[model samples]
Target chain A: MNARGRIPGIRNQHQVLFYALSTCIWCKRTREFLEANNIAFDFVYVDLLSGTEREAVVEQVRRWNPSVSFPTLVIDGCRAIIGYRPEEIQEALGL
Target chain B: MSEIPREKVEALYQRLYEEAEASGYHLNPDKEFTLGLVESLLINEARYGYWACPCRLATGEKQKDLDIICPCDYRDADLLEWGACYCGLYVSEEVLRGERPLQSIPERRPPEGQRPQEQPARAPAVSVTELPLPVWRCRVCGYLCAREQPPAVCPICKAKRDRFERFL
Candidate 1:
């Protein structure tokens, strides 16, 4: 019910946070790729947030991606891979 | 899945395809993928008051968002450099012909602060200076018109008049 969405997966090796726009097709692909690979992750639809909540989330994303592009994947609080980069996702999560 | 209807998505897809073709531009040949982006564009148009690019997060204010409209200000450059636009909706002729693969591209539009300010109004091009009317260029599709004001809608890409900038 909250802005953050969680999907269950058998693999939990890395803490994955995905910042995305609900209207972004690449964001949809990124979610589907995770689901297909059974990679657990938390996602936020940045476009759906309003007011201060939106501002805070935007700042969080900007820290990881200066462009604030959709489908930005932050892994284990260490590295961020921007765009729907499936290979990077696979390598980062070891999926 | 989004609540937007399949028929509505298909209709816009058709319209865009026709418009792109007429303008010597091409759309992605992947129907399902293109339709998904089209659906998002519709979602944005309904939510925001204009057809915002599906991939970019819109601030929901039409004035601040004028550059990122569906056929965004960067579409032509992105299409030339990457073969596909930022959203993969518009593709280059090579991509359409399968000579090149369409893939995810880095965002070309810089962050808000880093964006280059619009250039100062320039003197009219010397060759066209004698012409009576001023020229306006559509930032989206590069359509040019000689008139007192930019067209209310771009005849080629259908972008709003605000997307136009003085050319000469």
Candidate 2:
């Protein structure tokens, strides 16, 4: 999905994006697999955001995952699938 | 093969700053070093290719232990060790082989006034089924046994095969 629409009910409006460290092979593989499966997603480079820009994303991750890890998939709204497990991602997004 | 581009650096810096703000913490410059290291690893991989994952340490000794004779630091008993990655994910042959039970390492540092010891806790009644067959782990450095137990010599550190232990 394009990065234009907002998640209904969320105060700050921004489309869900895949938050990832750009150079990780697992991250790349996850992205490629998602794309290959025709799963629409926008990538947010965690390495490219400013201090204030990533505030919400980080909070959401902490609230879900036990740790701050790369290749975290934030979908629809607050739901997150941390790390790159193809099976988990498939099940999460219903791919 | 080339220096990190200004754009990449700026983007990385901005992202780290955002993460710090989001996480309610400051970013450490050492993170830049870690990023650089990973970047270089990626570049090298792209240029050359995938290499078999090399064992870092054999038994309890460094790889260089092969060059000199030794009392054979390798273990002949059952023991378990745990280590974690910067991302707080556990890294161990045990986990890779699916021998480890599900557990999460805490991300936050312990509160002030209490310093936890460095030892990692072991799982209860560790299933021997989960341990990999000791084909190549060094007795000296605890490196994974890639092939036959204790190769004629640890190709990584040159420790003789006699130094390896059977964890399986």
Candidate 3:
């Protein structure tokens, strides 16, 4: 679940990594949206991780975007989308 | 963290209900969920000595987190614009009445760098009997207490220490 992988048929060939909190309603909605669209994505529940592991993951996210908000979507390892913006996610993923 | 007694939490909830009624504000309609959040606030107060938002990570630097205390500075605006606060513990009247659906609210607290920097200051200690204690008011429930400092948790509203403002 930690390693990035390819999602077949995604137009941009961008690997998607979802950082989310297990208890966050918005994160759950975002996951449902992706699933409903038949989009293949990998997600990590940040809250479920151990303290040290969570800190490392959060640091990684901070390096990309300082807000460190929930439901952050990393595209192709470089482009990061903060929050659950469905329109933005669609535009970024070309879905 | 020490476990907070259920009775304490219930007392706080009752106070919150009264305060909200007086202020024309509405708590979340989901009673069980609201109770859970209040319980979390109590736990955080016990653990951290302040009632930090249970949903957001606190850096443990009071100055840096002045905006994110439970009943955060953004709650009123959030309720006005989005029908609910960031944590949905507080909601607009329409949402309480089921006239409006609660929607996801974008984070309103400014990012770390954009937040106002804390100014440094110091106050000399005074004898408790010599000076009147500062009065702190809970923004959420309007509970007022006169003490040298705000309580770790609002006994009435369960709002965090930072949610208190000096009234006198």
Candidate 4:
């Protein structure tokens, strides 16, 4: 279950890592935005994880966002964008 | 995820809309967005045994997650400052008037370990004779009232009695 759910986009120009909670509307919107833009990404529903796996995932998210808020997008494993800022997301992906 | 019915979501939406209006608060006028948050509230309510804010992760313990509960402790401040609560379910006058663009706000809540403990509320320090009744403040909305006991439900935010703390 540690494997993330991957959405294949028309182009995988950059490795996009998405951390989200399935119950969060903002996360949903972020997902919709990425899909609409056809950006390939890997996402995990943090809430659905349990036990040590959840802790490991939380640490992963904490590295990018100490607040650990939802819809965290990590582009190329170096830059991370917090929240659903469409303009920032586009800029990060160089779209 | 529990399968919440459309009627369940609609009923709660109508109730919250009416209650918010009655208390001089405004629900986000984007009906679809508001209803999405409402539906998430139901999911959290069923999963956590309380209505945790959909945008924040809930630890599933009522005591630890109390402040992040729906209509969260930060709601009023967020509404006042950002024109919308972090989750955007509740909005401010500016948003209601279409003067402010509604969007996701920064998380005012600190990380789990960084959070400050709830304010100390063991006893009232005011002179009973001078004030007659103690002042109780809603930790969520900052509504204050002088009374023997806090109201069963907060008139302004509708947070339950336990959410009230003695202010004076």
Which regions in candidate 3 have their CA more than 4 angstroms from the true location? A1-13, B1-23, B27-55, B58-73, B94-101, B110-133, B139-156, B160-167
Q: Give the candidate order by descending DockQ.
A: 1, 4, 3, 2
CA RMSD per model (angstroms): 2.0, 16.7, 6.5, 2.2
**Winning candidate number (DockQ):** 1
Candidate 1, residues B16-60: lDDT per residue as tens digits?
999999988888999888999998898888899788888998889
lDDT of 2 by residue, B86-132 (tens): 22211334544456532322223322232121223233344655544
Evaluation by TM-score, superior candidate among 1 and 3: 1
- lDDT by residue (tens digit), candidate 3, A16-82: 7888755455665677777777677777766456668778988987887676767788888878877
Candidate 1 lDDT for residue B50:
88
lDDT (Cα, tens digit) per residue for candidate 4, span A17-69: 99998878788899999999999999999888878998999999999998989
TM-score of each: 0.93, 0.38, 0.62, 0.93
lDDT (CA) per prediction: 0.87, 0.43, 0.70, 0.87
Q: What RMSD value applies to candidate 4?
A: 2.2
Off by over 4 Å in 2: A1-16, B1-168
Rank candidates, TM-score, best first: 1, 4, 3, 2
**What TM-score is obtained for chain B in each of the predicted models?**
0.90, 0.24, 0.68, 0.89
Residue-level lDDT of model 4, residues B76-129, one tens digit each, is 889989999999999999999999899988999976665424445456665565
> Candidate 4 overall Cα lDDT vs. reference?
0.87
Model 3 DockQ class? acceptable
Q: Write one digit per residue (lDDT tens) for candidate 2, span A1-95.
A: 22122223222233346766544445555777776766666676553344666666556555665455666777777577766667876677664
